[model samples]
Target chain A: MTEVTQPALTIDALGKKCPIPIIMLAEQINHVPLNAVVSVLADDPAAYTDVPAWCRLKSHRHVGSYELPGGGWAIHVRRNY
Target chain B: MAYFDAASTEPLHPQAREALLAAIDVGWADPARLYNQARRAHLLLEQARTEVAEALGARPDEISFTSSGTQAVHLGVLGTLHGRRRAGRHLVTSAVEHSSVLHAAGVHERDGGTAETVGVSLTGRVDLDAFAAAVAGHDTALACLQTANHEVGTLQPVTEAAEICRRHGVPLLVDAAQTAGRMPIPPGWSVLTASAHKWGGPAGVGVLAVRKGTRFRSFLPEDERERRRVPGFENVPGIVAAAAALRAMTAEAAQECSRLSALVDRIRETVPKIVPDVEVIGEPVDRAPHIVTFSCLYVDGEALLTELDKAGFAVSSGSSCTASTLRPSHVLEAMGVLTHGNVRVSLPRGASAAEVDRFLAVLPGLVRRIRQDAGVE
Candidate 1:
């Protein structure tokens, strides 16, 4: 598979937990251009599940999560509206 | 960390620690044995019983040690129910009784008995008239009411409720897990239950006080220990520690109560002023001095707790929508309060006014940030 690299807005939610990471995504997703990806970096364990669930509930595009070089995750979401 | 979850558990009191260490050496032998070492253990055990009963305003013979407060509630509720089974199998309790009593009622219903729950008011107080009506029925084998709510700290009208139960010829079991060591339980209660850890005693020791002639027999099969009220070998060291802690706490109760009450008042007054859309639950005047609970309308309890934890405050919540459980707090629900984003701050005996003020300083900005991130208006 081709290495898929996309330009994305980044949010540093590291050390923040669920509802927080999701809350950050909800607030900033609209600032990104339509169909552009927003990346949330978070360490709270609950964010792994809550971020994806939030995306599904809000009808946003879940661009998938990737492990950061350091500990924690980079969960990617795309603004659908 | 400012440990504001004392209702859950307090740090062991200093005297409890010393007594526990001393008792471990002397109380290791079985008090039920007939040897010389056993005689010493028996003496220590009897002394512990006397200490606990005196603190609780109970007789030494009436106080029996159980493994935990939940066990005491189980034995108190089920034993009384079984002892009065010939009269009726009906059990009555406030809807907000601890899960232990509620679970006991569940067991009663499972065994071909009936159970009824009385509701609470908006302030988390039991509706006394409704409680009286519930126990007024002819078949009410037992009625359970907490001295103060564990989550909200609302003091129930136990004395009045006890009188009603008396008129109805029903035994009243007061679950004083939240208040027993820190305050005196109102009189006229037939049976009482209290936990050790909540009042700075060691864990795994609970007191079950059955007033003489209350007509309670063990629900479980006969056993030699605790006069068959509680089965299994006694926790002699834990009992000694618990009794010592109770005595020490009672000695300082009046002073500590006023001090903690002032601290709680500070939090109560500050939280609403700092945070928007917050509802502070529980009766302001009639509640326990150590506990103050409030709810934020648009905040998530687990997230708030996480933020507070990061800010070095350990607290608890009654909101059902926390990360571990999706159900809202029954106490909050019964009281008709906002059930989401609830936080309960219960000051331990040594919690300082400075620490509480620091929490108050940090809470508002954090709530604002979370709400701003969530786009909550």
Candidate 2:
């Protein structure tokens, strides 16, 4: 169900709270093609656990998640190619 | 004492204090009795009902007293859902409702009723279209929304929301804990709940009003009391005090609300400007006039609250960690605003402009101290 908007993925989930990052990320991933990288920026602490669990369950790769400068965080996920 | 936590509980108005003391003996007897003391108690209770109903924009027959706002909300929500059980097991509500309503929703879910939390924009307004969608498809038994948030003071569009619920044949229950004595609710609210403490009345008194046509049922176990709605003996003196305080508060609400609104507007305009990296939360225009909130970047919320208290200014805050297992404020987080280090200040009724000035003077330094303590420049 990937939209494949671009092979180079862009998902801006910043300012989104828990379940939202997962929800937004899921929506964006559907648009991406196989093997695409999606960047997610979220501030919610729950997103830290939710995103990876979503990736693991969906068989997508959670490339990584890191703290964003100035109070938020960044997460990267790859679609299952 | 400088109590800025009016959101938590306002100082009892002078009239309410007088009423409570006077009623301790006079209204103490059971109205169910035949003695003169009982007759006096009956008169006082009836008068209190009239006064409270008028202040709350409700009818006497519709308003029933609860021991606290939390109870009112619980009874209102669970009771309504139970009454409508034949309709469906699904309910809809906003994300930023007070813990009372949210807690009721949890109970509803546990009881096998489905709960769908509608999203609120960062400014704390419900997403109308999304809200409609949540209630649209399902057998939505009821919808609950707060007239104004207790924590951030953001006002919700209850009137419009009522229309949406009406369209989908859903009853909207409004928790008016913050707005009851301030502004009148929209015409279409099916059931409404409020706390007297939030508006300068003593604790232990809450108001629940159900529209005449609403097919709601009480959730509490059977008793001849409350028409089988709320349980237990009524707090007669507390009800007297609630009625008196509501009357006194709203008598001057017109001028006072405007004055306080302007004062809070000043705080909204000045706080972020004076304190660097501080981001004020809530919609500037759509919020109640007595409260304002802001999150200071690199500042610790608990520390800011403590410093303010030490400086002779009492304020309130929901610690970031306490917001959820999730984050600070779902409303702030939903809005995508800064959520760290949030502080909510609610001005007391009858508070002076001088107090606001004193608070403004003390706050910047307190925030700076907090920042320093947090090891932020």
In order of appearance, the predictions have TM-scores of: 0.83, 0.83
> Candidate 2: which stretches are off by over 4 Å?
A1-81, B321-327
The complex in candidate 1 yields a DockQ of 0.04
lDDT digits (tens) for residues B1-377 of candidate 1: 78889999989999999999999998999999999999989999999999898899899999999999999999999998888989889999998999999999999999999999999987889889888888988788899999999999999999999889888888999999999777887998899999999988999999899999998889898998887799999999999999899999999999999899999888888888988767788889899989999977558887899999999999999755573654456676676565657899999998998898899899998998878767765
Poorest 10 consecutive residues of model 2 chain A by lDDT? A1-10
Distance from true location, Cα of B302 in model 1, Å: 0.4
Report lDDT (Cα) of residue B212, candidate 1: 93
For residues A1-81, write the lDDT of model 1, one tens digit per residue.
222337368999997644566667777888889988898898765566456646654678777888888988888887888
Candidate 2 - CAPRI tier?
Answer: incorrect
Candidate 2 lDDT, B1-377, residue by residue in tens: 67888888989999999999999979998866789998898889889988888887889888888889999999999999999999998988898888788889999999898988888775778898999888786688999988887778889988889998899889999899987787776678899999998888899999989888888788767866555678877788999999999988888888898898998999999987788866677888888879898766555566677677778888876546434345555565555554556788898887788988888888888777766654454
Q: Rate the local accuracy (lDDT) of all candidates.
A: 0.86, 0.80
CAPRI band of model 1? incorrect
Strongest candidate by lDDT:
1
> Model 2 misses residue A25 by how many Å?
22
> Backbone clashes per model, in order?
2, 5
DockQ for every model, please: 0.04, 0.09
Predicted structure 1, TM vs. truth? 0.83
